[model samples]
Every structure is written in C-alpha cells, then in structure tokens.
Target: MPMNRIQFQPGLSMPEFFEQYGSESRCEAALERARWPEGFRCPCCGTWAHCVLRGANRKMFQCNACRHQTWLIAGTIFQGTKLGLTIWFLAIYLISQAKTGLSALALKRHLGVSYPTAWLIHHKLMHAMAAREERYVLSGQVQVDDAYLGGERGGGKAGRGSENKVPFVAAVSLSDEGHPLRVKLSPVPGFTLKAIAVWASTNLAVGSTVCSDGLACFSAVTEAGCVHQPTVVAGRKPKE
Candidate 1:
C-alpha cells in the first residue's frame, strides 16, 4: 500500500491574514488601494481629488470636482452588504483554504452570521467566480468527466436514477506528459446537451483535445470548438 503524496501550495495562514487585514479600516484601505491602484478616481466624475468626510466613523469620499460621494464597498460585489469587511475576508479565507469546500451552514457557524447571510455570501462569491472563469480556455490535451452529488437514498431508488441528484462537470488540463496541470469541478443544472455545451463554451479552451467516458452529452464539446474522444468504459475491466 503505497501512500499517496499530495503537493501543497503556499497560502496565507490565518495569523498572517489577520495581522494584515484584521480590522475593518485595514480591509477598507486595502480595497481602496486595489480599486484605485494609481489613486482615488471618483467613479462618477473621474476626479482624482477627493476629501474624506470626518465624523460618524464612516469614511465617505467626496469628489472635489463633481461632489459625488461614495464609500469603500460602493459599486462592488460587497456593496450594500451589512456584514463587516472582516467577516467577508474571513469567509473568503475559509472558502479558499477548504479542501472539500465550506457549505453555507458551515459558513454560518464559522462567521457567526445567519444562515441566509451565509448562503447569500457563498452564492455571490461562487457566481462571481463562475463569471470570471468564462474567459478561460483550456489549451492542450484535457480530460473531462461527469460527476454527481446528493444522489443517494436509503429506502428508495438509488444511483443515477435517484432523485435530488446534482450534476456537475469535472475537467482537467493535462500536460504533455499526461499529468494534470489544472482542474475544475463546476456544478451545472443538469447533464443535458445544452448544459454540457454551455459548460464547454465557458470552461474549456478551443482546439483542445478532450478525453472522456462514453457519455452522449460529451459530444457537446465539439460544438464548443474542441475535439472529443470518448472512451467506452462499459464491460472494460479495471486497469485493462
């Protein structure tokens, strides 16, 4: 029984993250720097000069030219979010560091926020990630497979025909030596042709060779401008 070794990537530890972005002010300042790398350019008036309103704790940036006012999280995904930036940052950290992924319930317990807020935060971040992945095109040889979750039943029908099963696609970009370079596990509504096509269009790179099990939906990859090679697993013995 040989042990399977895993390569771990370097990441920000909890103590390090807290030391830097522990406070709300620190997080706000970080966001401001990220939003305006050069300097503060008013979103509305595009003015570089702005004055911070002093008084009731909330820092409001008022454009000197147009007098337009905005806050740190304004016009971004965190806009109108009542939760503090620290909580959001913690959620992001937990989500990123988790191997199996953190559920909304788990997030609620960890962040001490309500279930609804946790759910909202989780989905918002997930949706933003999905949107961002739309620009990725996996080049070179790739392997793809269909995966399912929540398809089990104790006293009823089970397996693929089971109710409440969630379908997702698992794909990996392979190097020339047949090693996996990157992997993606994306959830889809269902494993239909349209769904697979949509996933392929967004997640896969054009002109890549895709290898997959003999699933009909995988043909949709060709429609997305990629080559598909389906391997028939039926009646094939393990390691054959």
Candidate 2:
C-alpha cells in the first residue's frame, strides 16, 4: 500500500508553533509583518513616511504626510479586541489547526478564558473564515451533493425530512488530474429547485461542469449557466 503524500504532509508541531509565537512581542511582530509586508504605509494617506508613537497598550504609527494615526491592529480582525496579541494568535492557531473543528467550550478550556469570551473569539474567527471563502467561486469540473447536518431524532422525522437536520449543499472542484482542488459546504433553506438555483448562482462559475447525484434540484445548476451531469444512486449509500 502506498502512502498518500497529501494526507501525510508535514505540518507545524505544537512545540514549533509555541516556539515561534510564544511571547507577546513575537506575535505582535508577526502581525506587523503580515499587515505591512512592504513596510508601513498610512491607510488614510497611503504614504511611506510614518513615525511610531507610544500607545496605551502598543505602538501606534502616524503618517507624516497626512498626520493620520493608526494602531497595528487597526482595521484588522484583531481591532477592538481586549485580549493580548499572544492569546489571539494562539486562538487562531488552534482554530486553524483543528482537524475536526473546535467548539467554544473547548476553546474556553484551551485558552483559559470565560465562556462568553471564547464564544466571541470563535464567532469572529468563523465569520472571518466564511467571509474569505465567499470570494471564491467553484470552477472546472465540480462534484456536488446534497447533505444534512445533525441526525434524525427518535420519534421525529426520518431521512431527508428530519426536523433536526439542516439541509446543505457540498461541492468539490477537481484539478485537471482529477484530484480535489477546493471544497464548499453551504447551508440552504431546503432541497427545492429555487434554493439550489440560488446557491449555484452564488457559488459556481458560469460554464463550469457540475456533476451531482440524481437529486432533481441539482438540475437547477443549469440556471446558473453551468452544465449538469446527474448520476442516479438508487438506494445505495455514498461510499457504496
């Protein structure tokens, strides 16, 4: 049996992560570099000339050309955060590195913060991730399927009509070599044609080929100018 290179790729170890971003100064320096890769430029005046001033908690930069002042965290997701840069960076690292996803309760325990603070951090990070993902549209050969979050409750509804289930569409774009490229999992109102059409229009590029299960709503991809290829699964499970 051959090992899958992608699945076995090297990643940052916990010790290495802490070593790189252990102190507040280190985290602040990283943020500074990320925000201003080509050196500091005033957001308001867009000038390279700036002066550093002592802020209440951190250093502030003032543009010499327009006298505009801003903090390093200003206009970023870290803005208005009361937590230290080290805490926020650790939170980011934990959330991003979690393979099975991290809950607010788990984050609170990990970061030693209150439940409300953990919830806020989780919300902000998840929202930022979603906002970033919204910029991309699936193109090329795309494989799509209808799925549901949550499971069927004991005396409630079963199967697709389960009350506990939240309907969503899952799509994966493939590279030219048939390897998966990118994936999008989007929640929808229901499996109606109108809902699928709206989601397709938003998430798929025009003229892309969309391969999906024989769920009739998948035909709505055509409304978004995509070519649809439907495969009937009958009663078999996805893995089968």
Candidate 3:
C-alpha cells in the first residue's frame, strides 16, 4: 500500500499503516529531546559541551571538559539497531499509533523487510507491555480450569498420565457486581498435588474464596492453606 493511503491520526490510528510510517529519526529526535531537555551535555564528564558536532562522527557529542567524544545514542535501546533513522521511526510509529495491533506479516509487507525481522520487532514490543502483564489472584465467585498447552508426548501406558504435556491452570475472577476482572494462567509438567499447590499459592491470595472442581489433587493442594469451595463436575453434570 502507498504511504499516502496510510492515514495517521496522531494518537488514534489503524494498525497496518501505523507500523509502516513510524520513523526512527523521529523517535531518536524525541529521545534526544527528552534525555537532554535543557541542553546537550557531555555524557562522560557531565559538562555543557561543544557547540560544533566536530569531525565526521555524527552520532557522537564533543565534550569540552575532557575533550572526550561519546555516542549520543549510547546505552539506549536504539544504539545497536541497523535500520535507518527514518525506517526505524516509521516502524515505531506504525506499532504505537495503531489502535488494533498490526500483524507481523502486514508489517513485513509495509516495511519491505524479511518476515523474521518484522516478527522480532513486534514480539520485542509486546514484551515491554508491563501493565498488561500483571498477575493477580482471582477471587470471589471464580471458575478454574486446566488446559493442556504445547504437545503431548510418549505412547500408550508409559504415557498414560505422563504424556510429557505442559498443563496450565487458569482462574477467572468476577467482581461483586459480577463483572469479570482478570485471569491467571500457569504451565506445569504434571497435574499433581505439588504442582497444583504451587500454581494456586502463587496466583491465588490467602482468604480469597476459590471455586474449583472436586478432585483429589485440588483437595490436597487446597489444604496448602487457602479456603476453597468445591464444585464437582462429573460426566456432563455439575453438582455445586
């Protein structure tokens, strides 16, 4: 798609074009502005350094105190990036400006780069979303379930209960008003008493009422100290 067709609304924009146009130069400039809002100083000696950029080293700022020149982008995440300032800025713009997230494939097409590069950039960004990654103890009228993530392994009786599966426990907490709050997930090697206890103890807070299936494993784990309210699910029937 053409650059002009990709419209940006400063804060509220679409996903695809957002990734295509975010420029790294813009990002670097902003970084510089934010880092040195008052003025540029020699990072090494902390002096109100030279006015002239000096020589052909565009990235370095000259220091008058010790005459030491250091890279402006040093220690920042952008220091080692190989892409141009414009391209990097455009990539950042595309990712941040978009309301709904852009897929890696869409970003690859827009950025004219390899699939791996686009995927890496997107994943790297997703890693930084800390607020979205918070873990909470789901309490008060909750539903807990076990899910198998990854793949099953081994064969037959040898693998009966030891299928080398990555099992995950999940809990969804509801507010007093019954609005959903948050869910917690944890993966384990086996669905044992020890495993269940660990998962629950870490994710569920003490004294927070819990509702779960009436299983021996859950029984043993619940004794690890939280107050548990059991609901048995047999065949297709659920008995509270």
Which one wins on lDDT? 2
TM-scores of the candidates in the order shown: 0.73, 0.88, 0.53
Query: Which digits, one per residue and each the tens of the lDDT, describe model 2 over residues 105-179?
Result: 999999999999999999999999999999999999999998999954678878886789999899999999999
> If ranked by lDDT, best first, what sequence of candidates would result?
2, 1, 3
Which portions of model 2 show Cα errors greater than 4 Å?
A: 1-7, 232-240
lDDT of 2 at 68: 92
What's every prediction's RMSD, in angstroms?
Answer: 4.3, 3.4, 8.3
In candidate 2, where is summed lDDT lowest over 10 consecutive residues?
231-240
User: Per-residue lDDT for 1-240 in model 3, tens only?
Assistant: 656532542444545434533554445566678678987887667899565463333356777888877666566545666666555556666777666988889889878989998887677666654335555455566667767665645564333254555567777887898766887776765667888787777677666667777654555446546676677556533432
Residue 227 of model 3 has an lDDT of: 70
Clashes of each: 2, 0, 12
Which runs of model 3 end up more than 4 angstroms from their true locations?
Answer: 1-79, 82-107, 129-141, 150-164, 220-225, 234-240
